[model samples]
Target: MPHFFSHNFLLLAGLCCLLPGPQNTGASDLNKKRESTQCQNFAPTITNISLFLLQKAIHWPEHTNLVFSPVSIIAAFAMLSLGTKGNTHKQILNGMGFDLMKMPETKIHKCFQHLIHTFLQPNHQLHMTIGSSLFVHKNLKVESKFKKAAMELYNSETIPINFKDIQAAKTQINKHVMKGSYGHVLKVVGDLPIDTVLALVNFISFDGVQIGEFEAERLDKLEFQLDTGKVVTVPMVKRQGKFYLLKDNTLSSWVLMQPYVGNIMAFFILPDVGKMEELIQNLSHECLNSIHKRIKTRSSNLSFPKFTISTTYDLKKVMNTLGITQIFSNRADFSKAIRDEHVKLSKAMHKAVLGVEDKQWEELDFPDLHKNLLPDGPSVEFNRSFLVILKDITFNLPFLMGKIKDPKTK
Candidate 1:
């Protein structure tokens, strides 16, 4: 089993009250409009794909925290589906929650194209970058339609590489993944087969400062209870804000949502104690939609432990389990993508990293608290006493320790 490390930024605050501000309010309204417009008619499809992936991931042992971009994964598959033929194409579309017979091919492609274009729009407050690439072996000649769809619809670049040079090819692909993820992902492509004719790679990176940033001075070390009954100490942050909250009795869980600076928002679904398995078993699109509808804005006092987490998965098995088998088999047909030789997908891999840091401390250096907290002597002048100097700082018990970053800088 693969060991999974925490790669998600655990926001100290869960759901908080939306503060009143004309500028912020206007921005929020615009974001709402953009999101609604972008996801129209495609929301159900997106949610189904995302939920299926999440359900498969939840079964992975030792991974308590999970972070993978469903959009990135599905977009990669959608691009690949364009190159498939007959049943191979139908299977791919079906896995994506679309019936090829009912949905016109052009409409599906257009929806994905629009979604990608909208997601790539520049946002100063939140940084989200998505990249996709089609690496073909030098010997293979890609078809014009295939290349055009990849380049025009998915905005993916085509890189011609000599697969015989396995080391060089691996290094090149790994470097691209690293650069695409802004160094958060060190590697993705591992050992490449000698017959590797083509590789499809996708990357998604997200970084954003909390709108209601955490106070560095208020960070407290406290005990955190893990699902395994292990009590560990960790750095915790706290804040009070208006947040949408819902008590999901049917699912026996609680759902909380908090917005970021842009259209992106994070929803956390926490299961009731000892009911985690039930919650995971009950995961569905209907449950999520109901939670969204039931949630209402209210003042909430939230505190949470933070973590930076990374997860990697060999999706070949997962894809096969999802009934997308022919693509990886010897009988695979890719006549639309390439005509030079018989080539089939040999591997599918993905790696994602999530980092959350307190904005206040992430961009600042640790101060000399020992010297700053102490006075020159007990007889020091009262006018310039340590007590007066200490008034600005706060200290807590040495409970747990972890890395802290100043959030002021990117």
Candidate 2:
């Protein structure tokens, strides 16, 4: 495009790029330009002409580059395609405690990476049914939600004055922030004495009111005794170092636009995935079956527990069958081992099928599946969602879970 019209523009642009010295239009400088004029005039022109020739060569319709332009090098090496965020949306959300399924379009190299990760994640094959599903949630609204969990564990939000001697709320926030990265820990989160980063985690994992109610309720549950040995983190409504709840953009503006406001009137149906099923069921269905209510999307679109768990569960189902067999094989040779552990396994299976495990629970870890979302290890977040753009939608992912390293037994 630039070649045809700007004979001098192309030359000038290249000269500006290549020029080593400072720009000065004084007589001294003009004399210097003239003295070195031959060398200066010749170099960039050769560069421009060579570039034009290379384009002309590749014009017969072959992706060939004899000399690497910055753009060409990036494309050829498959480097420019990956973003710096280091995790795809699915990878970020995977173990973050949510049942999410997101497959926004991405590059070809990146898709294969996601496939490998999906493969490595724990599956249902030899296992038949998942008793461990009880360990985890069907979805985010259940497991990660502090308020709802607190209410179920200890009813009521306003703490009974004497029931629990509460500690003055102590909040922990990491002030150092890296813009465009999840590196900085800005606020606290969760209703439990958990190491969970509350606000951001909830913003990612569960709904907002659930976050608020849970924090308030957890405060109520904390007996001063309970606060001593517990290493719990709480979510603050404010940004880092600030002492107030961050204002909701919609609400702040609605303060004026609202003709009348008892509360917002909206209907929302956040589809459930995983243990989130039970949590969703526990709540009044204002949107799913149908109800009138105020709908709150995540804190900010950025604060979503991203999990593009493949909706194409064709592979997942096949793998589940394999998991069942591997975990519970009784070929008679397993006499000693089966005799020892079969009791526990059977109990787990029975509990899972009967829905008792979800109630009488313990911890269970699934295969960690993250490295698969995109290649080059988590394409960066160029936009709000930290997504990479692609023209086609393919079923494959970027990689398979290369290996399953047992997470530490905390």
Q: Kindly list the per-residue Cα lDDT of model 2 for residues 154-272, writing each as its tens digit.
A: 22121111101112111221111111113322322112222110111110110111111111110111111111233222111111111112222321111001010111111112221
Which parts of model 2 have CA positions greater than 4 angstroms off?
A: 1-114, 117-327, 330-410
Error of 1 at 271 (Å): 1.7
Could you give me the TM-score of model 2 versus the true structure?
Answer: 0.15
Top candidate, metric TM-score? 1
Error of 2 at 236 (Å): 3.2
TM-score of each: 0.74, 0.15
Question: Model 1 TM-score?
Answer: 0.74
Give one digit per residue, the lDDT tens place, for model 1 in 1-410. Answer: 42322110000000011111122222324654554464355655666666666557645443444555565666777788888887778787787777656667777777677656644555411445566777887877789889998888888887887777989988998788666555655556667666676877776555542423322224455665555566566655444444565667987765655454435555555566666567666766566556656788654444554455555566666576578877777666677887645556667766555555556644545444412321221111101000000000001000011111211111
